[model samples]
Target: VANKGLKDLKKQVEGAAQDAVTAVGAAAQQVVDQATEAGQKAMDQVAKSTQETIHKSANQASESFSGFGKKLGLLK
Candidate 1:
């Protein structure tokens, strides 16, 4: 009877430990998912800003060249 009690106690302890590990794993996964989502959003914003800068630079260069051509009497 004493040995049976010991065995049952050991099983209960193991089950509790497993439950704790599962809870910790789920919490860690949630943190990782949130970080990934935030990183993706930041990357998207950076990409958009980069594209806008490129477009503005291109427009400025085109306007400058056009003005130079007009001054040279090349485009009238």
Candidate 2:
């Protein structure tokens, strides 16, 4: 009877340990997902800013060339 009781106790302990490990694994995965999402957002913002900068630079260069062409009488 005592052996049976000890076996039951061992089974309960193992079940509890398994539950804790599963909970911890789920929490860790959530953290990793959040970090990945945040990194992607940062990269997207950087790409947008870079595109805007390139557009502005291209406009300034075009205007400068147009003005130079008029001064040289190359364009009417």
Give Cα-based local distance difference scores for all models.
Answer: 0.98, 0.99
Q: Each candidate's TM vs. the true structure?
A: 0.85, 0.90
lDDT of 1 by residue, 1-76 (tens): 9999999999999999999999999999999999999999999999999999999999999999999999999876
Locate the minimum summed-lDDT window of 10 residues in model 1. Answer: 67-76
Instruction: TM-score for candidate 2, please give it.
Output: 0.90
Q: Pick the candidate with the highest TM-score.
A: 2
Q: Candidate 2 on 1-76: residue-level lDDT in tens? A: 9999999999999999999999999999999999999999999999999999999999999999999999999977
User: What ranges in model 1 sit over 4 Å off?
Assistant: none
lDDT of 2: 0.99
Task: Kindly report which residue pairs in candidate 2 clash with one another.
Answer: none
lDDT score, candidate 2, position 1: 100
